[model samples]
Target: PTLTAGTVKGNTAGAFGYKNTITTDNSYVVGSNSTISADNGMVLGNSATVTGANGLALGNNTKVANDNAVAIGNGSETAAAG
Candidate 1:
């Protein structure tokens, strides 16, 4: 199951701002504009992005761009670990 819980008021993307999320199986995005593009990935903060399988991004603007990577701080990014 997929779940997204948040407010998108005044966001440029509007209610549709919750795009690009959970494209793969078992992925989850819990905030506005967060994205989880890989299987088993998770993005739990506003505008966070996770593009790698098993990756996790937990703060605003955080990004986990590589497989098995994790980013836990606001605006933090994980290096490509391929």
Candidate 2:
């Protein structure tokens, strides 16, 4: 399944606020308002953003904007630009 149980926003519009699906194969987004826009991306906390493939965001309001990037802790962001 694309989404398992207890997903606050799964396969439903207006929860993620983006055209892309909330979670794709090899991708995992596990928080309210988090986003993953590419493959192999992971968003682990609330309000996180991952715009690049193989990116990871792991806290509230964190952002990973480039490919093969990782952001850990709260509000962490990758310096690389997409």
Which candidate wins on lDDT?
Answer: 1
Per-model TM values vs. the true structure: 0.72, 0.68
Distance from true location, Cα of 33 in model 2, Å: 0.7
Query: Which residues of candidate 2, in runs, are more than 4 Å off?
Result: 1-24
Query: What is the C-alpha lDDT profile of model 1 across 30-81, one tens digit per residue?
Result: 6677766677876778888778888988889998989999999899999864
TM-score of 2: 0.68
What overall lDDT, based on C-alpha atoms, would model 1 receive against the true structure? 0.69
Model 2 clashes, total count: 0
Q: Candidate 1: RMSD over Cα atoms?
A: 7.3
Q: List the residue pairs that clash in candidate 2.
A: none
Residue-level lDDT of model 2, residues 1-82, one tens digit each, is 2343323333332223222235534676666667776677777778887887889888889988888999999989998753
Q: Which ten residues in a row have the lowest lDDT in candidate 2?
A: 11-20
